[model samples]
Target: MGIAGRQNGVTGGMILHRTVVLVGMMGCGKSAVGRSLAARLGVQLLDSDAEIERAANATISEIFARDGEPFFRDREAEVIARLLSGPPCILSTGGGAFLAERNRQAIHDKGVAVWLDASVDLLWERVKHKDTRPLLRTDNPRKTLEEIFATRVPVYQLADLRAETLPEYSIEETTDRVIEVLLTRPDVLEKT
Candidate 1:
């Protein structure tokens, strides 16, 4: 809590009137930044993936393997809708969540989507070593990532707000950037 920000009530604290749905590529730090942003705002961070896993009683990869991507997506949508219907909180979604039009509409109708933008190279570097990503279990993950990136970025651009995730910035810094962007949408968040 910087004195300047706290005195001005810019970054010191805020009242969230709507759920903030974090949308972007997998490695864009949605979960990490959501944690920090929720903490800064004195609210809960509900991770859609975690919620789905809890209800299904399985890891994401295991769910994908057992029930398939389509089934997982159906469950994801349900979880997202359910979370959005609750009181305002930070919602971190899976990378593919925003790609679906139904999910996008639900988010816009109930919450605000904040895209956490990152370059394809940055995203690849972050996710390449992680086998937990069921989608990246491919013969050429880098190429697959490129395709996914190209397909999804345009959709991500439709978010109500956006925050850049620079490799040089720490999670806290990125979270601050998210706060700055959210501050712009006074209807969604307000200084308190």
Candidate 2:
């Protein structure tokens, strides 16, 4: 039975009550964990970055290089709003998505924000080899990541829920932790 699916507290099929928006720093496993959570919950997974890429017909890096970060952020906000307004599902937002007050307000209004928290060491290990992150493509990428991480943690903590990630945990383990957190909020995920 799905985690939230229940009738009189007995396991059955779940009905998603609200969108679960995953917010965190890059390499924090938001996408991977969100995908697993959605599958486990029998729901769809909406990735803001992928959605933005599809809408713009360009990669995030391409958009940044061509139109700049402001333009990319504008598109990101639009995609996030569109996704949140759609249905109750798992939404994985880009690392910087929750940094904007407008985006945070929208998420708070329409969904439950779950910050997939991970240490900078773990995040660095995960993103060190990835070229897809535009913000990390600096001469000193590690330093850049550190700076971004420092600046974003406070904002991410504003999320309604927090799912901490560790290098020792597999994707399933992380997803399980997230589920535990979500279940604590009956309005977000019921026992049934």
Candidate 3:
């Protein structure tokens, strides 16, 4: 059952006033933490990347290969907008989703962005074994990852709330930290 089953089951009935958007660089555990958080809150967990892939009937890498990044980014923005218009839920977006000003504005207007902060080394440790990450398919993936990390850190800082992930924390612990951050902003999430 884990933390989700252990948490007060009342979370399912609690009112979510706005979407909780998880924004961060790749390997920051946004997807893992988002899933745990949604289970703990008993709300829908939406992943913009997964939604885009489902809508396009292709993997993100395929979408990028055939349509290019500009097209994929456009589709990403559309997916984020469509999802945000729905009921409040937990949204785990792609690492680059927050890089666009338009997406940032949409998230700010309809949701609360939570930046999951992890050290670059920690991020590398988690992602080094993953081959599915489209953006890391480079001759020097580590340097590429570092470059992306440096560029995205500033933008991620613009999120409404922040949660830190340590090497020792489990996914549920990270989700709990995110919940603590959300609790500080009743406009986004409230205890019922």
Top candidate when judged by TM-score against the true structure: 3
Q: Estimate each model's TM-score.
A: 0.88, 0.88, 0.90
Worst 10 residues of 3 by lDDT: 1-10
Candidate 1: segments with Cα more than 4 A from true spot: 1-11
- Put down candidate 1 lDDT per residue, 51-115, tens digits, no spaces: 99999999998898999999999999999999999878889888889999999999999999999
User: What RMSD, rounded to one decimal, does every model reach?
Assistant: 4.3, 3.5, 3.6
Candidate 2: stretches off by over 4 Å: 1-13
Poorest stretch of ten by lDDT in candidate 2: 4-13
TM-score for candidate 2, please give it: 0.88
The sequence of per-residue lDDT tens digits that candidate 3 reaches over residues 135-171 is 8999999999999999999999999899998999999
lDDT of 3: 0.88
Q: What is candidate 2's lDDT per residue for 68-122, written digit by digit as tens?
A: 9999989888889999888688888877789999999999898999998999999
- Residue pairs with colliding backbones in model 2 are 4-192, 5-14, 5-192, 6-192
Task: Supply every candidate's count of residue pairs whose N, Cα or C atoms clash at under 3 angstroms.
Answer: 0, 4, 0
Q: What is the lDDT of candidate 1?
A: 0.89
